[model samples]
Target: MNPLLDERKATVEADHQWIANLEVDERARTGIPLLKVGFNETFGYYISISRAKADQVPANYIRKQTLKNEERYITPELKEREARILTARDDLHKLEYEVFVTLREEVGEQAEAIRHLSRAVAAADVLCGLAELAVYQGYCRPEMVNGRELKIVDGRHPVVEQSLPAGFFVPNSTELGNIEETSPLPDLIILTGPNASGKSCYLRQVGLIQLMAQIGSFVPAKSARLGVCDRIFTRVGAVDDLATGQSTFMVEMNETANILNHATSRSLVLLDEIGRGTATFDGLSIAWAVAEYLAMEIRSRTIFATHYHELNELAGMLPNVANYQVTVKELPDQIIFLHQVQPGGADKSYGIEAGRLAGLPTVVIQRAKQVMGQIEKHSKIAMGLREGL
Candidate 1:
């Protein structure tokens, strides 16, 4: 364009006349006119007509757009001029684009070096952020090892606790791997508690701490001795994936099966309500067997949170299985969530109590309590039979 020849300049000048001044009615000063011409990016060129004078438009006019008060048309002569102008503009643009693509390819020759530098910078940036987080959050450096012994003292959920009132987020501890003289493998925690307790948060916090430690980042713990895990599997909650044609129970079972299939002793598994998605007896049986397999066959460090209080019996039956509960303090009329994790099994799930606390209808609460009592009585008898007592 800078040094175009005489012929090219003359051709460029001729092309400009194509769209320079589209035809319009000079009678527009008085009122809306029937015939007019316009050019825009969308339709390129069109003739406008007012409904009152639409009959005066030429028969050769091709209707392109219709409006409430008027219609737009394109004539053959206008269309031919538009096509020529557009073709010339497109050719110029394509030539420029080709030049740009060639230049881009020359720069792409150095793409490999750029990508390596980018990865290094990204890693450095992540480390800088982690270091800042450690300093601000009072995180301590974790001691990482390979041979079992997963321990974390006073560990807090990094994100969950930050939003809580200061010192309100309870710091819990975790200990896995059988250190006993006669034991065969690591221990599995059977976590049980009422709804809305810190059981889920505690489970996630343990996994997060271990993951952070293994990745060479300081963890949100007073002290941590982490065992390097090959994989960290978590099945926390369920939802019906109807679009995928799977029920809530099916989704839960699939995820549970995946964990059971691939998880090794070196893996860390956090299972929340393994079989609560299905029928009571079926769910309980599956959950009970899954825990046993994890403890005996896979021997992985696992935190199993559940609403099934009956699963607590695993502590007595399996040596590698231990029980833990998120304790709640009962008030005169309301139960306060303590959010504390402590040793031993829970006496009750406190679901009805929790519903009552959540402002459930008084009549419903009373009926639930009555039904729970009947269920418990029958469950105790069934349990005795299962134990052959």
Candidate 2:
């Protein structure tokens, strides 16, 4: 990067040429083809002549060291040349270091200006990308308001839609909080459906749309009018924190407590399978209480996605609660995932069908069916207990 660096490098290389030529010249003078110039840290430079030809060396060659098979010698001229080489190399290195320090200081002086420019360039890059996405993906600009409302018509997940073929990704609508003329939409939606029915995708879509709208970017939707949210809280998957010695259920409870402690009416909360990490009854009770609190107390624009069909009862008890499900088509032998979110709750999760599709053993599937029938027959007691809660 600096011209001085190149100049010093060339000078050092040029100085090394003399040492090589000395080796050739000494070999010719001493009539010993084995005469050579070598350098080491202990002895800077020397000419090595084999012991048999040591007597033939020129008288000007003062002995520096002797070995069993060779004698190391240094002439006055060689010493002078070695000193010059060492001094030139030292000066060159010092000059190169000075050049680097100067360049670094200059960059440090412009650090603030460079950082400001970088931020501006980064922001421009993001806006350019969003603009290109809007043009190609047919995204719409959402209307942003200051109320507790979020409505999206025919919205698709921005990332998921890209993975799917064109016209294949089913678009779903979301309505929350109040719209002017229509009946007041629910503040909290209890999303129930079969496993892998795209419930998580749908929840993410709504959150992404709301975030895109607030950030002045077009949303992946046909139309949207989103209220500005103070925050977006999400608890989507299960993971154990082994480093902290916390089980999956404990980690889930910690995150849930944090959300409940900080979430407000102006926030958007997306929860998935809130209590599946614990026992059935314990999990059900916690899920029910969490849904009820989010709906009645915090009044956050929330989507509670769960396999707990019993949660549907919250819609009848809480005025700001509603039920939604991702529908499926059930055949005699198997089920088809429709991946369509619509009103009303689903009673069955069709998890056994999912296992069957996943290639579970036939005997295992059959035994699971029998076990499920027995569990359902006794589930009335659990249902009654849930109603009491």
Candidate number achieving the greatest lDDT relative to the actual structure: 2
- Candidate 1: segments with Cα more than 4 A from true spot: 1-99, 180-186
Q: Write the per-residue lDDT of candidate 2 for residues 153-249, one digit (tens) a residue.
A: 9999999999988999999999998555457899999999999899999999998998888899999999998889999999988899999899999
In model 2, the Cα lDDT at residue 232 comes to: 96
lDDT at 229, model 1 = 90
Task: List clashing residue pairs in candidate 2.
Answer: none
Which regions in candidate 2 have their CA more than 4 angstroms from the true location? 1-7, 17-38, 45-81, 163-168, 381-389
Model 1 TM-score, all chains together:
0.74
Q: Could you tell me which residue pairs clash in candidate 1?
A: none
Which candidate gets the maximum TM-score versus the true structure?
A: 2
What are the lDDT figures for the candidates, one per model?
Answer: 0.83, 0.91
